[model samples]
Each structure stands twice: as structure tokens, then as C-alpha cells.
Target chain A: MNPPNIIFIVFDTLRRDICSIYGGDVKTPNIEEFLKDSNIFPRAVSSSPWTVPSHMSFFTGLYAREHGVHEDLEHGDGRVLDKIYEYNGDNIISYLKQKGYLTIGYSTNPWLSPGTGFDRNFSSFTFFSSEYMNLEEMNAVNEYKRYGKNRYEAAKNLILSGNFQEFLKYYRIHKRIIKRKREVGYPFIKGSDLIFDHIMNSSYEEPFFIFINLMESHEPSALWELDIDDRKIKYLDLSGREIISEKKMERTRNGYKRSLEILDFQFGRLIKYLKKMKLYDNTMIIVTSDHGQALKEKRKIPYYGHGNFLYDEIIEVPLIIKFNNNVKINIKNWNQSLVNIPEQIKNSIEGSMDDYMTSEYVFSESFGPVHDFETLIKEGILPSDINFSLMNEKMFYPKKAVYWKNYKLVLNGLTGELDEFTENGKSQDPNEKKEIVENLKEQIYIFKGQESFRV
Target chain B: MTQEIRIEGGLSLNAKVAIAKIVINDAIDRFKRPFVVWSAGKDSMVVLHLVRNVAEERHMDMLPALFIDHGQHYEETIEMLDKISKEWNFKVIYARNEDALSAVKGNKIYLKDLNKENQEEAKKIAQPGEILKDENGEYFEYSLETSVGNHILKTIAMNNAIKRYRIDALFTGIRWDENPARSWEVFISPRENPPHVRVHPILPFTERNIWEYTFKNNLPIHPLYYQGYRSIDGKYDSKKTSDKPAWEQDLEHTKERAGRSQDKEGMMEKLRRFGYM
Candidate 1:
């Protein structure tokens, strides 16, 4: 028998408990139907709380420490391209390509774009902008941010700057975006529909690998003015510059829920098309997330976004796997790390289905703040009084977690101390369960190879 | 090759000592009726001295030390245990499995005459051809060299001691660099079956760190270690790896447990899973 074709989907920033399949409130009816023939891993953890490191783990089956594609104190992605070029030859994409599988990738995340090494071995890779960012929309947002408050002044400033054609075009795009926001109750961010549309239109060879990343459930949640920038929000959230209002959090969270509903409808369309194309039975489909988003969840520190925190809201993600031919497999209640995806795919290709994805120990990692706060301050996105040095020192500690059965141990790399020890999501005193903490800490040390651990 | 535990990689002798003391204080604060597992070796002697310092700080009497007497200990080990406990003004509890020891006849122990616990332990751990049967009953050799003998004689004996005294925690001097199975151990670990915790205050200490602490504190050195044996275990099975003292030998390139029984060391993971320290 031929090897199964693979369809890997990542719902960027999708939380597990929020989905109905994992016993959450959000009604993912399409996901519920998919679960009938799928295995749902309730305790799947992403390797990092943000995009670059988590996606690298998915592609390479190694932790962020191993790949060295992670964020540090002052820079977010300065060395991404260099690291990817250096290590891309040994990843799952190259492995599958060598195995005679035609690999293709589609992503709406800007970080996973073509030049960033995320598209290395793909036969074809495309980055779909979440929102329609034609040259006109870019000018409109830039012009709006430049001009203070009045629309006429912005138009006057643009025309005075010898950009009259650009001014008229920007005005038209600005009006259209506002009208679209009024109609849809949210700003235009590309959803799963764009990827599904492309998939339906394209023709592929047998035994192909399809990778897709959908960004509908990400931030910029509620309806926004065309001038409201994501970088401003990102800076404020990650730097803890401002205490977000509860009302704003509720609005953003509700918008996120609505986005999930839209995503479910779009995903339902893909399942229908796969069945119509007669590829449903022979295709191996996996739907998971890179990481989960935090909606001002109350933690040791209130978490509003991903990247810096190791809280449960940020690391726990949803995992749904539908093996080819709808194989009946036992799903053990073990913590499954996303780093094992590559090996799981290899085992499936070799027709080894006996406890193929079982993991005795799973891990997640985060190295300080993912954004360059200094740049944000210089760009006027944040206030100069943000205490940049203090924030960097406080948030720059490399945090890692090790999960075994029901217990989790979060260790701080800087002080060599236990940050938090929890069982089944409730914090326990480390003094009480020192054995479990030590065991999990040992796993974390081993997972992070000794060379990285020393540094 | 086995991966090295890098927790103690860049730490200085003073920093490692501070961390070990913190672990010891945490064990004292959490567990009542805690006891130190002393083998009269260099590592445990350092732990005992650290515990004495902490006790002096808190103005409370130090806890007793647990010496596992499996009938295979050297006379020097027993003498050190006696002299050190008296000099340090602490008690020493002898944890001996007398039934298993008394069943030894010639080189073999008759399994039928052993206690139910020893018989069950022998049945589980004794390899094929090791347990022989006569017309009377089954029998296995009385030795501490094999995994079965260690589990029955050492682990089972230690577990019975825990049950007898209701020790909430047992502090030991097992270092991460000591054995492959012990590399992943934490400062305080909970074990089951007999229901107690294993407090490893010096897990992050290396061989060199152990010696540095020994000399800095001017603690008593195990006679066998000074006589060239790096690791002093059962008298019959352990041999000297070199003619020089342990600290004088090549510590980094050589394995520390080279003198211990290979049969027991090879199956350390299995032995540990069954509650052996």
C-alpha cells in the first residue's frame, strides 16, 4: 500500500480548552465532526508560546534551544534567516521531500514568510496577508498615523507632500476598509477561507504534504480603525506598559470566539471538498496550534499576550489527528509535545501504528521577551519611561516546562529555581511534591542538551 | 555515551555548598522524622556535617543517621559509623534485614526458609539459573554483587526500616554524576510502596565538589577511599580502582563507581525504580 498523503494545519494562537472538542464553550461543530474519526490530544503543549520557535519545533522536531531560532532580550528575529539557512537541511520538510512527497506550504503569518527559511524545501510556498494589504491600504494606514486626528489635514498633508495620486487612492481604501468593518463587525484579517480556496483550485501529485497556517483567531480582535497598529498593541501588552481594561478584554475575547466560529465554517468547507475529491480516506490530516493566546488571564503576572509567559493559557494548545484510513488508535492521557510531530509523521510513513505518538516526557520553552522593546520605544510605539532595562532584566529569564502525567514543573533558567509546580493546572507547593519537581526538572535539563544548559 | 547533568557545571564550590544547604533546610522544614542515610563514605559524611551545621543554626538536635547493615559492610565502615555518630552527638539507626542474612548457608540462601517479603523479592529479581531448587525447595546465592541480591538485601532492608520507624524523608548523598540512573534526580523526590521521600542535598555536586566540601569542612574521610577505592560499597564486591587516594586519582577521566559491582551498577535504573537509594 502507498503511504498516506499529509495535510498539516496550524491554527495560530488557538487555545485547547476554548474548543468544544476539548470540553470548552466555543462551538466548533466542524471540529466535533472531525473528532469522530480523529484522535484528540487534550494535553498537547507547544514548544514555545510564540510563532518562530514553535513553528521551528514543528519543522525540525527539536526544541528552541537545539535550533537556536528563539528570541532573546533585545532582539526578536535578527538571526532567524541565518539560523534557518544553517539548519534547514535536516528538517522534516527536507526529509519528506526526500521521501518522494511533494511538499507545499501556505502561511498567513508574516514571520513564517518565504525569506525567513520557513519555506526552504517546499515545492511551492505562499504567504497570504491576514488583511488585504494592497499598496493603497499601506499608504492609507501610514498617512493616517502621520496626520494627527483630522481627516482633511491628513489628506492635505498627503497632497502637500506631492502624493496626490497616493492621497486619492489612500482615501478610497480608507473608506472601503471602514465600510467593510461596519458590515462584518471586525477588521479584515485573512481567515482559513483563503487557504481553502487555494487548495481547492490547485492540483497536486500523489503522496503530497500540505502545510497551512490560519491566523483568524489571532489578536487585533475587535473592530479597529484603519490607523490602529498591531505593533502598538504588541508593545503595550508584552512590556506590561498599561493595565488593559476588563471591558476591552471582554470585547477582544468575544471577537476571538467569533473568529473561531468563522474558522470552523471555513474548515467544514475543506472537509467537504476533500470528501468530494475522494481523498478523505487516504489522507492523513492533523489540526493543531503553534501556541495559545492570553486574554488578560490572571496569573503570577497578568498575561495579555504570548512570547514571554509560560502560563497554562499560553502553552496549552489543541491537537487533532485523523490518521489515514481512519485508523482506530488508543489515545493515552499523556502530555504530548508538538516537537514530536516529525517523528510521528515518520512512523506513520513506515506503517508503525502501535503507540506511534506516545511520549513519556514532553517539554515547552521560552526565552525572555520576543520583541525588541528598545526598537519599539524608538519608533514611538511605546513611551520612553517604560523602564526598558528593568523590564528586560525581569522578563529575560529563559523559562522552560516539563510535563509528566498530571504534574508540570516550570523552571527559571537564570536563578536555577523552580518558578511554579502544578498538578492538573492547580499550583502546588514545590516543597510538598519535591520528587515530581526534581524528576521533571531533570527531564528539562536533559531535553535541553548539556551544552545549551551550561550557557 | 550518557549525557552529563550540567546543573553543577559552572557552579563554584561555595555556590554548590549554599544550594545543598538550602535543600537540606527545605527537607527539614517539610518532613518530620527525617533521617540521613549514612554509608560512612565521603559523600554522606559531607551531608551529615551540613545537616549538623543546619541543626546548630536552628538550635535543635540533629536527626539520626540510617546505616544499612546488609551483613556485607566492612568493619571499618561500621567503626566509622559508630565513632562519627558519637563524636557528632547524633544517633545511628541500624537498618538490617536479619532474616535474609540469617538464611545464608554456604554460598546459597534457601528461599523456602526466608520471609514472605524476601521470597517475593527473590522471585521478582533473581535471574534464571540463579535460583536453584533441591528436593527441599528453591534457593539462591547470598551475594550483594547481583541486582537481585542488592534489591533484596539493600533496598528491601531500607524499605523495612522506613516502615519500622515511619521516616517521612531519607536524606542521602547520591550525586547526579555518581550514576546514570541518578542523573535526573531532584533535591527532594517522593517514592512509593513504602511511602517516603528521598532528599538528595548533594545531587548537583560533582566528584570534585564532594571532595572540596569534604576538605573545606575538615570532615572525616572513609578509610577505603584513602586506600585507593573510589566508591566503597559491599566489602566483597568493591575493589580499588587505583593505588592512590580518591582525590589524588584522575577524577574527570575515570568513572567514580569503577570499584562497585558491575552487575548491580548495570541495572541501577531497575533497582532505583524498585525504591533503592
Candidate 2:
């Protein structure tokens, strides 16, 4: 048989427990239906707590420490393309492209845009900004950037070039987008309607690789075209600068549920379209997340975002894969790391199913706050008086979590302290399993190439 | 400190600078807590300058410089460090092994008087009979030539700083063209004992490239490099190679680190394995 077409879908910032299939209250009907023939990995761990590193791990099959494309105190987002370019010839995209696959990419996340080197070997890559999905807004953003973010300069240049009509058109679209946002939170982000419409309109050859990153379940909750603006939920609720009222949080949670409902509807539509096109059975669809988000759940500290901590609510993501061929494949209920996504794809291409998503040891790493929070404070985006000392102590440390069997250990590299040692997700004394702890610690050292100093 | 061959010689200085900036930017992005291992030497100065450029572009303050204060550095070196760091607005954190420094008596360091931690480290890296005796019992010469001395004074100090500061990445100035041991190293290398990654941003640069970058960027030059010494280390172990200035000397055929004789006869590989740069 020929190689099957691959469709890797990333549900950005999606938590496993929130899904209905994972025994949560949120209704993900489409995903539950997809799970009938697919393998659902309930214990899959992301390699990093944020976007760039975790996605790089998926593409390179290496941890953040090994790949070295993560965030630090000095850098949060830009200039990462230079580092990503180093893996151009060795990444999964290039590998599959070399194997005669028509590689295409669609990322709604700004970090995975073409400017960031995420489109290295793709035949065509398109970045659909959540706010700039309309052609007019995209043209306006491009023009603003062309003039170095100077609106007046962009207008002057456009008018000078005899493109005054185009300038007016861009202005009208920009105003419409902003007005829509002000009137009803965010528009068209949750359903991914634009992306799905694009996909339905485009035709593809056989044995192709399509990578899609949807930001529906991400932030703003898209507020359901609700008048309630959940945009400040990220800055105010996440940073704990202003505690969200219980009623407001309940409304936010409901908005999130509605967002999921919208996403599920879109997903169902995609599935139906694929089957209508007679392509559902021939496509290998893999759905996973780079990392999960924290909604201010009970914890040692008030955590609200994904990148600062390695809590289960942030690192544990869903890994569901529907392979093309139907075979009685044994699903090992072992820990799986997102770093093995590349190997799983390769195995699928080679017609292998055994041990495809199984691993004895899974690891996840975090390097402090992925965003430049200090700069935010300096720029008054965050309150300067808010004390970051305690938060920094908790969030700024380099942490690594190792999952072996039913035990998990999260070690803090800064203090050489065990931030967490649990069995089956409950706190446990590490001394009772000293051997396992030592072995896992040695595994970390070896993975970091520091085994020579393991005592 | 000595280089035998110039293997990666074809890249233009601009290309080398671009690659080094990429490496530096990646390290700044990947590691939570990072420091530049600045020794106030030419190669390290280039590394510091490159890191500063990236940090400035990113609107980040310069990473603190970890100066391995072995208590044997040149006065001019210290003066240059003080002046330049003040002018450039970066912190210089001295990584000194206080236990070993305080135990020094004239030219000999009493090994028995060191703390138990320092003694254990010295015992692990020291060769048999290398620890001699003076009027005090079981002492080693306060010299950087011995593997044991270098380990106790510099490596131990640096490692302690790493543990103390919880440094996850250290930007060092080791180049591929510097020595055979470092020739195999990549842009980012992980180290043990204290467990941190070494970010070698200038690994592809040769001695000539270092000078060219220094001159083109107008980086601060060590006074001794102008006085015919190609490589400057602790004043006790360094010497002048020729009467001519460093750049005027025969760079292609002559040894770049001829003045620094600590890395002699396969000693650098051993020192490097024991956490010496």
C-alpha cells in the first residue's frame, strides 16, 4: 500500500481534563466521536510548558535542553528563527518533504509563522492571525509593518503610490475589525471557520502532509461573540495583579465551554467534509497540544498561565491518533512524551503500530516565565508595585519533571530541590522509593549530558 | 590556552559574527540563568561584546561576568576589568575559591588546611606525589601549571559559583581553533559536576578572527596583547612571545598561546575534562 496522508492538528493551550472524553464536564463531542477509531493517550506529557520549545520538540524528537530553542529571561519570542534555521535540513518537515510528501502548513499561532522559520520545507505555508483573518486586516498589518509600525507613514506611502483606494479599503476593514471586537469580544477565533473554509476550498494531492495549529481553545475564550471581554483574563487573571471575581471566573469558564462547543462543531464539520470527499479513511489524523493552560486552580501558588510552571494542568495534554490502516493494535497505557511525535509519524509511514506511543520514561521541562514579564512591568502593562520576588522564586527556576511508571518527580535545577514527588498524582515520600528516585535522577543527568557528575 | 591548528578558517568575519550572534541569542533564550565567563582576555572580550550586542538589541541587561578570581591575575587585568565593566555597565562576579585563597602562604598552598570540600576536589583531580611539602605539611605550589592547582583554584571556584548562583548556562570563550580538545566542541556544550551548559558563541573564531573582530568592533584590548603577548592568563604563568606586537607577530605559523605554558603535553584535555576551559 502507498503511504497515507498525514494531518497533524495542534489544539493550542488545550488541557486534557477539560475534554468530555477525559472524564471532564466540557463537551468535546467531535473529539469523542473521533476517539472511537483513534487511540487516546490520557497520560501524554508535553516536553515544555510553552509553544516554541514544545513544538520544536515535536518536530525534532529532542527535549528543550537538547534542541535549545526555548525561552529565557532575556528572550521570549523574536529572533528564534535564527536558531530554528539550524534544524532546517534535519526537521520532520524536511524529512517528509524529502520522502515525496506535499508538505503544507497552517498555523494560527503567531510564533509558528513563516517569519519564525516554521515553514522551512513546506510547499506552501499560511499563517492565519486570529484578529487579522480578513484580507483587509492582513493587508493593513502588512502595510503598518512595512512602514515600521508608523500608521501615518504607511498612509502617506500608499497615497503617494496611487494606492489611495487600497489605503481606504484597509482603513475601513481595520475599523470594522476593531468595532466587531469591541462590540462582541473576539470574532471568528473559536470556530476556526476561516481556516476550515480555506481547507475546504483548497485541493491537495495524495500522500500529503498537512500541519494545522488552531487557537480556538486558547485565550479570550473568544467570549462567544459575548459582550463580556475576556481579553484582560490573560493579564489580570493570569498575573494575579487583579483577582477575578468568582462570578466573573464562572462566566469565563462558561465562555471557554462555549468555545469548546464551537470548536467541536467545526471539527465535526471537517470530519464530515473529509468523509464526503472520501478521504477520511485514507488520512492519518493526529491531534495533540503543545501545552495546556491553567485556569487558577488550587495550587501552592496562584498560577494562571502555562509557561511558568510544570503542573499537571499545564503539561499534561491529550494525544489522539487515528491511523490510516485498520489493525488490532495493542495500546500500551504507558507514559508518552510529545518529543516522540516525529518517530510516531515515521513509524506510521513505515506501517508499524507496536510501541508507537509507548515510553517507559517521559520528561517535561520548563524555563521560567516564557514571556518577558519584567518588561511588561516596566512598560506599565503590569503593575510595577506588585511584588515579583515570591512569584519569581516559584516561577523563574528551571524545572524538569520525569514520569516513570506511576511515579513522577519534578526537580528544581536552581535549588537542587524536589519541587514535587508524587505517586499516581498524589504526594508521596521519595525516600520510600529511593532507588527509583536515584534512577530517575540519573536519567535526567544522562539526558543533560551531566552523568559524569551523578553521585 | 594554546591552539595547534586553524580548521574552520574559510568563513568571513561577518559570517562568523552572525553565527556567534545566533548562538548567543539562543543561549539567552534557552537558559534561565546565564553568565558570561569573562576573563578580560581577548577571546573572552569578544564573547562578552557579542553577548552585549544581542542583549542590547533585545533590550536586556548584560549578563553578569563570572571572573575566575584565582588570586593570581595581573593587576592590569583587574584594572581593565574594573574600568571596562563600569564603562560598559555590566556586573563582574568574582568566582574565587576563598578556602584555597586564604590558605596560601607565599608561593605554596597548604592542601591540608583547605576545607573538606576543597580537599576532596583536589584529591580527586590531583596526581600522586604532585602534592608536595614545604615548612607546612602537604602543600602544593601556588601555580596554575599543575592540573591539581588549576582545578582547585579556577575550576573549583567556577563550579562553586555555578552552584551558588544556580547558573544554568555559562557563556565561555573557548574556540574550536583554540585547542584539540575544544576543537570537537559545538556552539552549545553541557558540563557536569555543577551541571550547567557552556555556551561557546565564538567557537568558530580563530585567534586572527578574534583580533579582527576586536579591532573592527573596537572592543577593549588587553594591555599585554599590545605588549607582544599573544595569550594572557594569570601573570605568574604567562610570558612574552616576541618583541613585536601580537598582531605583527607570525600568527599563521606561531603558536597563539606560546606565552601561556600551562597547557603543555596533553594537559589541556585533562584540565578540560575536569571542568577547566
Candidate 3:
């Protein structure tokens, strides 16, 4: 029997609701077409809403609690591996390699780079140059001055310069401030093409396991082409005043949609290429995103975006897997988290068709100092300068509903209150809030009670 | 009767001047064939400035800078190194443990691998005068390759082309206060197998002294330090603040503890779980 070739594609900041297969208005014809033949998990959720931890969970098959690589570490104890239980007694790449598979990974997110330990399980991994982003790079000393003078100015200068090298310098100066935006405009498909070509033409005699990450929807959404008809219109409200000019909004949304379409198109082409090469039949292709994006939609918080909160829009993502002809299981009703992926892969490999369910409740946390109320104020996310001394203080609030067999419970982190919202002019009552608080508190206590996974 | 003189402050003007003169003299003495270890960090920047100053003062030929690229350094570090190299017109050479880094890149090696490999190799590469075997035929040697003959040979081969052309002495800017391990390093030491001598011109200096000197001398340091980072260890910290005490904000000690030998097994376990091992 031929070893399965695996293809893992991650779309950065891609919201599940926007995809056509996920019941959105987005014109993802290629994706919709592909999903028809593939196994799509409509209720797939992410371990974390943010990129780093989410990707960690996906690859390691452990919740953030088990791994402990929660936020960026300036000088991490470098003991990240000790916290992880050898899901299969080895990493995914090592396991696959032992099975005679050639591993390759390409990501536009720098966090996925080897510096952050994400490159560990892959034979080859490449990250988009952070130099392309218009941000000040933080040096060791500047990292000392977390929120220093001219921080934004330095970042803006780098952006304005448009020179990759200069941008790298600025990026070092203000890494904390510009990390997200710097991740926004990566050319995902183009970068992956380089790896794909190498894999196709290389003389290496091994089945391939390829991973690709696309960063189009991250931030400063800059992928739309101005020529599309859907993006060319201009609009005005009933007052004849422009809430958002039709042409501009169309241009922005169209650009983002066009990029998604391009991703889908490329994915289809890659699959076809693999099929033509006779590698598709044995390949188990899985499509997933680290996390979903916030498209300026109203959530518990009146605003739309990831970070500071883990709402459905941020935590829920699209997961699709196509496993040649061995199995025909449609896991439509099964809600799973990214952490369940590795075990699922193992079970699938062993030909286990039993109803394998993910844990009922998964947890995540972010401890970066930038999440303080002051930074939010600077970013204009909050109403005023709120005392953020309580930001570091962990507060747990239970979710309104635990989806997928009551196994999965959502707990609100630091910004839980800000995300509280009213639906149709009616706010949730004290009882609803109390239930959420209780569930969240229980999860927190459970996390605290567990022996520190520190080796 | 002669009046006894009393200095108004902790250090007298003469004492300060004498100390400055001694520092300048030591810098000049070391600059003759200085091989500056340029990490593009704060201390290295000061070292480079001191070397340049010494060269200018004595009208001696400047030495080339040496950079050991671990391949995972921040982009800013590379850029600053390039800029400083070009601005100062100093020859720059970057040496990398490609095998180790590639192993790291391929997930075959990790931070623990470094310590493990170093420990194993340490037992095999004993110094010339040191006892390498016991009477019962048990073999023993130095605990680190940093002082090994083969490592010295490799370093010479890797660095000789540039160092032979210019350097006679390797000038390192390591300060005693950076880490407990560095506290015992002497001001000067002879190379194990090479002809060149190792000099720590800034051995007596504290972190504050280095900062004061760099500030007074207007040296170009890697800008990350100004942002809030206190160490050269490649890690990310998002909450560093300039106004706060470094110890209060910096995670260097915590991070260092993660890599210590006392926690070796634990660190290895963490590395394994993260798939780094």
C-alpha cells in the first residue's frame, strides 16, 4: 500500500462564515466545488483565536493547557517540548518521516518560523520575510522600552519607506505594536509555489507531506484588485451621506474575496497537479485555518476583530479533509477543535471508524502586556483609559452555550466584559452572566489544579 | 602639620580620570589585533566603539569583526550589523554551526541537543595539560568544547582566514554582571591551542558602567535595547517598559533558568513536547 501524501493548507484570518461552503455569501466557487467531494466539518473550532497558540494546538494535538506556549516569550525557558505529551510518541513530521514521508512547510506568518519552534516538525519550513511589513523592529533594548516614544512613528516610517530592509529595522524597534499588521499582507500562494516546484521536481524518493499557510485576511486587508465588477460600485445611505463609499468598500471586500478565490483556485490547481502526478489518490488532504477573522461584524463586543477576546467568529474555523477512497465518513454534526486533528489523523491511519470525539471543553489564554487597557486605548478599541491593573488578573466567564455534545465549553478571557453585547435591543440578564461566570470559573480552577506541565 | 585631603564624593576627580585613562589604555592595548565578537547587541556595540576609539587614538590598523550566525537571529540584528559594518568600514565575517542549525531546522536538534552534544563532546576533548583518563582506564575530559583542541582547530580554520590577516588578539566585551556564569571570567586568558590571546577589556565594568560609557561615547546599539529588552538572548517580550526596573520587567533570569543544567531533563521534556527535539 502506498503511503498517504498529506497536504495541510491554512488560510490566515479566514472567517468560516465568509466561505461559501460554510453558508456565507462569499463567491468561493472552487472551495464549494471541492467541499462537495471532501469531508467537511462545519462546526470545527480552534483552540485559540490567535495564530501562535492555535497553530501550536493544531500541530501538537494538545490544548494550550498542555503545551504552555501561550504568548510570545522574550526569553522563553526554551522548554516548550517538556509540556507536550508525545501525542504519538513523536512529532507529526518525525512520525510521518519514519513512515517514509517527505515533510515540507511554507508559511507567511513569522511566528510559524523556526525561531518560535514551529519549524520543529517539518523537514523544510519557510516564513515570509517580516522585512516587507511597515513596522519598526524591536531591538533588545527597545524591547525593554515596551511602550516607548515615537513607537508608531518609527513603524509608520518603515511602512512609508516600503523598503523591506528598512521595514525590518523598524520592525525590530516596535515588534509588539506591528506584529499583527506585519502579518497582514503576506503573499501566501506565490511563496508556496516555490516550495511546490521544488517538491515536484526534486529527486527525493519519499511520499510528501506538505503544509502551506496563507495570510490574506490577517489585517490591512490588501489583496483585492480594483478591476473586479463586484468591487467597483460607489454607494450612499438614505441621508445621501456616505457611510462607506460603495467603490471603496467594494474594492476592499472584493480584494479580500478575490484573494480567497485565488487561494481556492490555487488549491484546486495544486490538487490537479498532484493528481496528474498520481500522488493525489493516496494523499489525505486537510484544509484548515489557524483561526477565523473578524470582518467588522458585531460580536459580544460592538467591534469586530480578533485578540482580547475569543468569540465564535474568532475561535470557529473551517476544517475539511479529503481522504482518498479508504473511508467515506461525513463528520458534519461532529464539532471538533484543532487539538483533535492529530488524534483523528492517527485514528484514520489505523482505519478506526469509531465515533471519536474531541474533549468537551478546551481552554486558551494570552498573557502579553500589550493586552493592557492602555494599548487598547491607543488603538482606539476601548472607550477611554480604563484601569488595566486588572488585565493581568485572570477572570473566567462561561460561554452562553457549549456546542458539540456539551463537550466544548467557551470561557471568556480578560476582555470578557467588553465583548458583552445586546441582541435586538435586549441585553442578557444577570442569570445568563452568572452561568457564564460559573462555567468559566470551573475551567480556570481545573487548569490551576492540574500539576504544572513543566518538565 | 600637613592637612589631610578629603574627597567630596565617592570617587575623586583624579580617581575618575585615572580610571578613564586606564580604560583607554587597556582598550588601546587590546585593539592592536582585536577580534571583536560582534553580536550587534549593546555590549558588543560598546566594544566596537571602544575598538574604534583605541584605533583612532593610537593610529593603529583596525581589526575585523566576527559574527557567529546561529541562523535564527532577528532580522533587525542582521540589518544593524550590516549598517554598522558598512559605516565603520570594518571587515565582518559571519561563521555559523551550519550542521547544528540545519539539524535544528530539520527538528533533529534543539536547545537541549546543544547542551547534550556539548556535554558529550566535553568528555572527549580534554585540554593538553589536563588528565583525560583515570588509572582504571576510565576516560574523562573537559566539560565543554569551547576549550577543546579540535574546536580550536575548527575555529582557527573557520576564522583564521580573516583573523590571520588582521587579528592577534580576540577582544570580547563580556561583562561580569550579565550572568552568574560570567562573573568569574578573568580580564585576560591565553588561547588553548592557538597563538592568539583572549582579552576581556571590559571585565571590570558593570552593566551600568557599560551603559554610561555607551551613552557618553554615543555608540550605535541595536535599537531593541531601547525598546525594553535587557538581554541578547533571542526571545520575544511584548510588555518591556523603559521606566520600570529591568529586573522587574525582564524575563532573562526566568528564561535562563529554563536552560540551566539543573533543569536539563525538564527542559528536554518541554522541548520534546513542543516538537523542538
The per-prediction tally of clashing pairs is 2, 0, 58
Tens digits of lDDT, candidate 1, B1-277: 2545444678888887899899989988776568899999888888898899988987777777888888889999988888888888876778888899888887778988798768889899876677888876888767787777887789888998886555778999999887778888888999987778999988888998888888887898888888899988888889999999999999888888878875343487777888888
Chain B TM-score, candidate 3? 0.60
Each candidate: chain B TM-score: 0.95, 0.96, 0.60
DockQ for all models: 0.03, 0.02, 0.01
Q: Write the per-residue lDDT of candidate 3 for residues B225-263, one digit (tens) a residue.
A: 666555553332123445443334443224322322222
Name the top lDDT candidate.
1
The sequence of per-residue lDDT tens digits that candidate 1 reaches over residues A1-455 is 98899999998988887888888898989989988888887799998999988999999877787677888754765555677677643788899999999999999888887888798899989998766567667666766756533456668888888878867776888788767655644443564777889999988998999999998878777764235556566556555766567887788888888878888888899999999999998999999999998887767666666787788888999998888998867777688889889978988888866444546677788877777766666656667787666565557778888888998888878877877788999989888887877767755654543223321
The DockQ of predicted model 2 stands at: 0.02
What DockQ number belongs to candidate 1?
A: 0.03
Q: Higher DockQ: candidate 2 or 3?
A: 2
Candidate 3: stretches off by over 4 Å:
A72-90, A130-204, A223-254, A330-332, A353-455, B1-277
**Model 1, TM vs. native:** 0.63
Tens-place lDDT per residue, model 2, A1-455, is 88889989998888888888878898787888888878888689999998888989988877876677887655554435667776543788888988999999998888888878877778999988776447656666666646423455567778888887878876777678778666533543543776788999999998899998988767665343243233334555554667767665666567666666777787888888988998898889989999988776777775655786888889989888888964436778769888889888998889877555667778888766676666555433455676566556767677788888888888887776788888888888888889988877755543443211111
TM-score for each candidate, following the candidate numbering: 0.63, 0.57, 0.46
Docking class of 3: incorrect
lDDT of 3 by residue, A65-139 (tens): 445555322222223333332223245667777777778887867667765666776777877643343333424
Candidate number of the best DockQ:
1
> Regarding lDDT, does 1 or 2 come out ahead?
1
Better of 1 and 3 by TM-score: 1
